[model samples]
Target chain A: EDKVVQSPLSLVVHEGDTVTLNCSYEVTNFRSLLWYKQEKKAPTFLFMLTSSGIEKKSGRLSSILDKKELFSILNITATQTGDSAVYLCAVNLSSNTGKLIFGQGTTLQVKP
Target chain B: SAVISQKPSRDICQRGTSLTIQCQVDSQVTMMFWYRQQPGQSLTLIATANQGSEATYESGFVIDKFPISRPNLTFSTLTVSNMSPEDSSIYLCSVGQGTYEQYFGPGTRLTVT
Candidate 1:
């Protein structure tokens, strides 16, 4: 079955801690891998990785994809309490442009 | 990126009642989708609202229960019929931005009593 798996379901860290979230997928064919941060009711878009090795960075958040290995990782540097949220990884299938297969997500708790 | 908006950000409705959530996009989009997120669970695709046609539902979802309509490229609506406690979830609408990304709305938090 096509699925996206995220590692370290939950994590607790103090401010300034760096964390790496893993996402591995087993899908027939996919177009891209995406990351989002859910702080409350809405999830904010983080990064979209379509190419391998090339890391996409915004502020302290960065993500990279390994298409050959069928995995991706999201790294957060210098985390803060404001970064406490569920970080979700999703695979955008190549066959379907409107659907997203989401992982269980990693709950990151940043303590002050 | 599309700016999506959903109506009735949060609502508490009694069991068996039905609620319709509207989604509007800033520009015309080719694909509009509806998703449901249960408490403590990840998001699940409910259906894809096709413009000028019947919505396509995902596995385990039915049209009679979750009817969707896309009257135009920039707007869509999802109606949850005969709501149950299990139906209480965050209903979100997203528009396909370009070919790889989907921009989501604020979402409607539905509570069933």
Candidate 2:
């Protein structure tokens, strides 16, 4: 069975804190891993990591993938209250396939 | 970038009543997908909708219970039949962009009582 597991299901941190979220997947034909942020509505795209050891960054958020280890990590630097949301990690098993195995998201709460 | 939209942003319905959610894409897409997110759970793929063909459902999801239609490249609909409290979820529509990225619609939140 293909599965994606995320560690630290929920976290609360004061503003300016740095947090690391982990995602590990056990699936066949791993194509890429995607990260998303969900607030009150649907998730918004963050970063997609396909190459191991290479980091994808945008603003205060960044992510890296390890194909050999079958895991990935998302790091948020100097978190703000606006950054409080559920961070989702999804694994795509095939190319151009819309089917993605998603991990139970990490609930991040940034306190001011 | 492909833009997707879903009708009825949020709805409250009674159990056993059915509701059909509509999805529209701004551009022509070969692949469209439907996903369900239960309260406090991750998204689950319900089915895959392709233009000019029947939707392919994922494991544990049946066509009769959750019927889907893709009449054209940019439009699709998903109907949840015989709704129950367990059926209440956030239904999302997604479309493929190029070979790697997929864009999501603003999901329809369904609450059954």
Model 1 / residue A78 / CA error / Å: 0.6
Give the alpha carbon lDDT tens digit for every residue of B1-113 in model 1: 78889998999999999999999999999889999999999999999899999998989999999999999999999999999999999999988857567778999999999
**Alpha carbon lDDT of residue B45, candidate 2?**
97
lDDT of 2 by residue, A1-112 (tens): 9999998899999999999999999998888899989997688889888889999989889899999889999999999999999999998888856588899999999999
- For candidate 1, give fnat to 2 decimals: 0.65
Report how far residue B45 has shifted in candidate 2, in Å: 0.4
| Model 2 lDDT at residue B37 | 98
**Model 1 alpha-carbon drift over 4 Å, by segment:** none
Span of 10 residues, lowest total lDDT, candidate 2 chain B: B95-104
Per candidate, the number of residue pairs that clash is 0, 0
List the RMSD of every prediction in angstroms: 1.0, 1.0
For model 1, residues A1-112, the per-residue Cα lDDT tens digits are 8899999999999999999999999997788898999988888899988899999999999999999999999999999999999999999886465589999999999999
TM-score of each: 0.97, 0.97
